[model samples]
Target: MWYNQFRKIQKAGDLMGMTVNKELPLPADLKSEEPLTADIIALKQKRDREIRDIFTGASDKFAVIVGPCSADNEDSVCEYVSRLAKLNDSVSDRLVLIPRIYTNKPRTTGAGYKGMLHQPEPDKAPDLLAGIIAIRRMHIRAIKESGLTAADEMLYPENRSYLDDILSYEAIGARSVENQQHRLTASGMDIPAGMKNPTSGDFSVMLNSVTAAQSSHNFIYRGQDVTTDGNPLAHVILRGGVDKYGTCIPNYHYEDLMRLLAQYQKRELNNPAAVIDTNHSNSDKQFKEQLRIVSEVLHSRAYNSELKKLIKGVMIESYIEEGCQPIGSNRVYGKSITDPCLGWEDTRRLILKIAEEA
Candidate 1:
């Protein structure tokens, strides 16, 4: 009787041509979190403390999370972060550098190379099982080799536990910021999580997300009832937004920052802070314009002490090379295959300049 009922439902759904395709291993089925070597654990803990301190007003160091738009090439990303590690030493007084090792990329149209979390090798077809292992290994290698605790997008809330032990910061992308699961997962995170303003550019939606993330909640996670104590380190990231006409309008200006500050003040949230994403719609995807955006935000911070206090840091999309290329046989090394990004030389100059200003 149960089989007949299932068959009836399946036949009914078949009228719409729906089919269950494949099932992949759960996180527990896949490789477990590797035991952190003493050195890596210490490095991660130290970096996590500095990041949390910045959010909590315990540390005045401006946190800068910079790297490629996606971790398409592991070697290139590792090399890029190694350089950032040396630079971090030079500017330890004023800035906290967290290299981005974002393995997941959210596509607007739901097509294209999804990111390292989908294709460990961009040119190859996605092997999810291999991709999971590869991303974890890459993140671990980045921390072990460079002493830089990295940041990654929480593109899949359920996958957070896979890297929970390794990542120092996590971000809910503009496309996923308004999602209930994303907000709830962030609420459980011990490290800082940034919730970006939605692509629709609604400040209220973003603030509401922050509120949700900073509140305690009980939810079902991985087939079990879990409770979160609320993540007080949840904050905002202003990545600009698209207008109704689909044109990119910037929100990194002094006026925009001030407006965000005003809205944040009215909210009853903890660790009220925001990070200016210099790339994306803010720079109109003109990768070179990121330099100017960063400089301008720094000027705004200098002009208003309150703004300075509210604005915690900046997120820059950068890699070894500048610009981007369509994923194909002839892709450029270190250039982004997703969004255009600032090249290494320009990125270094901007970081040093920001440190000087800070």
Candidate 2:
């Protein structure tokens, strides 16, 4: 291996002095194309209103965001969304259901699907173009069939045009919230947005993101000069942090959130509310703990007046079935294959419990 490495190094020097590698042809200029339609806008507006009503206390409904940790299979994804849509109507009055259509998955070590964007290969086929096509097709079909609005974590700004028409809500993940490009994208985004805090769970970073996303800003959008309306609905999501951990077993630490809410009100921010991500640090990335955290939050609302108004929604990483399997494996149907998740039975019971309490 050492001898091969030396031989490869010599070849790299020779190649560097040889003909240069030309830029690959750019994909068709789909970036300049507009895809969002009237019907899509109408659905988006309706869902936006529902979210607003929930946060503003004009409605008694609780917001529930549930779906796969990351979307991969088009056929299976559509089927799952369709099922969620039916469930949405059944709980329509009491809950606002938002189907999570995330296509990007950021890894701590930079390995994983990265969504269907970087790897179309479910079975070792490296076709990124095919991956993009498959994901876009799945997103459109889900919107058309599910009659449900979708939410995505906006990662690649250039990829926005692909799903702009289909997405209703966008989230800036913990790692990306502090990024200027993401903040700019959030400002220009037409849909309501949520910004999560830094991985350490600092509210100030989230507050800054909220301010950036909610204020009008000038930025380039698809080779055109553009200004955004600035998504006022942008809010904070407290998934908890190790800093707030009990230094032992996992706990939601309601006091941590109460302090955050007071800070929001003190800053005179919009609505003074926060969405508790029932996954991640709040549950210590243990999927089953999601249910307990959510139940505790919902049930504790009675004594926590501040929480009653501030906790408008809960984000759960769930799918058609429970728990996760290894990526790219031919595993059980409906298993996450990404992050471990609360199984269907437990998820259903938790949702019903939250609804009953709400």
Candidate 3:
């Protein structure tokens, strides 16, 4: 059905002036998921188990998925992960650290840098074929070097298979969380997928997306009919929401968490959990505020035992350097080319503090 729908759109575009440019390689053709080195495989297995255990209430460790907003430079990202790899050992008992390696970024107005999956080189034109290969290679390198199975956003559901084998956790971004394809794809993945609240800030839409992802469905995926067994690990990610006045309002407070708990109870979904995105609308894109926001969330958890169980972890956007830079300017090493992110020093401090608090 998806192929047929694409054909119909193509036919209509042909009548206009649009034409098919090229056909890319299938996932299998691009890169086979040959087993990784035994050590890396063991690391992934352990990380995956810990994450699932946290969601299922079998563990009390806080999960922190932190890294660059978009992985623009491979070297800088790998360096960041190396730091996280070392830090993970220190806090392993209290926190599960999964570095965020978001390759595909959804632009709000369909403009700006679309992430490494589109442009491996920020200053060059998009070579999707090369972009595909670059992303896969980068993910492989991160895991091989850092011994960490990173988290990435499923910006394009169809493209997820390219790195699915390496990703320990997946997030359906605010813009894509409401889309049917994204939700369906999450239902089939073995890794935990966090469905973020939509831009509209509607809790029902977020919960409904979780419900869809946690239920079985038959759908057209990659030119094939596929059925999913329903992902019980599908959970919610409150990244805050934008109000009608075009303002970013927070949803990470005690009241907000209590409200989410109420909603989850009403639904009675499997492995109920929430991952609070400290940046985005919650911090109103003010990167520095992430420290305060995370500190407050931990305080809320300390205040309420139930909130601690429901709030599984937090998502943080941090890079080697502080804040963000424009796309074509002199790119700062480890600084974000997309969203402004918390700098490395503050990020390190915050993680240690979170571990201490947790």
Winner by lDDT: 3
Ranking by TM-score: 3, 1, 2
Candidate 2 lDDT over 1-358, as tens digits, reads 9979966766565555663323222334442343446786687778777777776678768888888888867777788888778777667778888888788888778866587665655556556566666676677778788878888888877676677766777778888989987898788776667888777777888899998988888878666688887776788887765555443223356677667776887785655667778888777777888877887778766678777887778899888788778865666777776788776667677777776787
Model 3 is weakest, by summed lDDT over 10 consecutive residues, at 13-22
- TM per prediction: 0.93, 0.85, 0.94
Clashing pairs in 3: none
User: Residue 352's C-alpha lDDT in candidate 3?
Assistant: 97
Q: Name the better of 1 and 3 by TM-score.
A: 3
Model 2 spans > 4 angstroms off: 1-41, 242-251
**lDDT (C-alpha, whole model) for all candidates:** 0.90, 0.74, 0.91
Q: What is the lDDT of residue 295 in candidate 2?
A: 73
Model 1 spans with C-alpha error above 4 angstroms: 1-33
Better of 1 and 2 by TM-score: 1
**lDDT score at residue 50, model 1, on the 0-100 scale:** 89
Could you give me the TM-score of model 1 versus the true structure? 0.93
Model 1, 246-308: lDDT tens per residue?
999888888888889899888788989999999899988998999999999999999999998
lDDT of 3 by residue, 226-331 (tens): 9999999999999999999999989999999999999999996999999999999999999999999999999999999999999999999999999899877677
